[model samples]
Target: MTNPYTTAPMPPQPPLRPAPKWARKRYVLPALALAFFIGIGAGGASGDDAKTTAAKPKSASPRPTVTVTTTAEAREPEPAPTVTATKTVKVTATPAPDTGTVADDDSGADVYYANCSEAHAAGAAPVHRGEPGYASHLDRDNDGVGCDS
Candidate 1:
């Protein structure tokens, strides 16, 4: 029996070499050439060729213009003038005071309305001596009360 799969020996690679200076010279020459041309063009001076003359001040008129005047005849004196002055006065009115009834010293009335009005109206509580339902509710000394408390 013959072997169908067989391999041959490979050849060895060459050693690595260092880069030569001339390898970069190709790129450097073009850059230097561009910079030299740019310097030469930028260094040249440019100016306008047209010649300019100095501006002169304008001359004034030989003589100044003057206005003319005319005179009138004088007249005789007349009678002295009379003046009369009149003065006016202004008046303002004050408003009338209110005569309506005012609820002063309203402690008892306010207390009755706020705490006892509902109970009294519903008839749930009698107007007793110390209870809010009673007219005598504020009697702190309790002699069968009224605002005396």
Candidate 2:
């Protein structure tokens, strides 16, 4: 609600002074960037000088070559052996007298083996009733099943 034409009082201000040219921050960043690039260029130049002097040329005529020689052999293989059937010759002669001294393995009581495995392997197991090798000792129960153990 004060008068509109009256101006307000201005605030107090401080005095200014320039910083030192060498200590200012605006030029420090560009100077550091220039020094980094110079160092990298100097390092790369020293490495390239060694590769140019190590190269050398070689001659093909100075190397040696070898040539081999072998004696030739005859290629005819050995003849294979032939197989022939032999013809048996029969000699005609007179007959001899009869003899009854031949031995028989299946004698009286020693007919079957001690176990069924031995009897079956010898073609003698499961002898039915009234068969050639059937007997009372083989069929214990007399039910017609012999050597069933």
Q: Highest TM-score: which candidate?
A: 2
- Candidate 2 per-residue lDDT, tens place, 1-149, comes to 97767797757787777887876767898889999999888767454565664454554676576989999998999889989965443322222233655435424223434444545665667867655455567777889967766
C-alpha positional error of residue 94 in candidate 1 after TM-score superposition, expressed in Å: 72
Error of 1 at 23 (Å): 3.9
Least accurate stretch of 10 residues (summed lDDT) in model 1?
87-96
The whole-model C-alpha lDDT of candidate 1 against the native structure comes to 0.51
TM-score of each: 0.20, 0.22
Query: How much is 65 displaced in model 2, in angstroms?
Result: 90
For model 1, the superposed segments whose C-alpha errors exceed 4 Å read 1-7, 39-45, 49-149
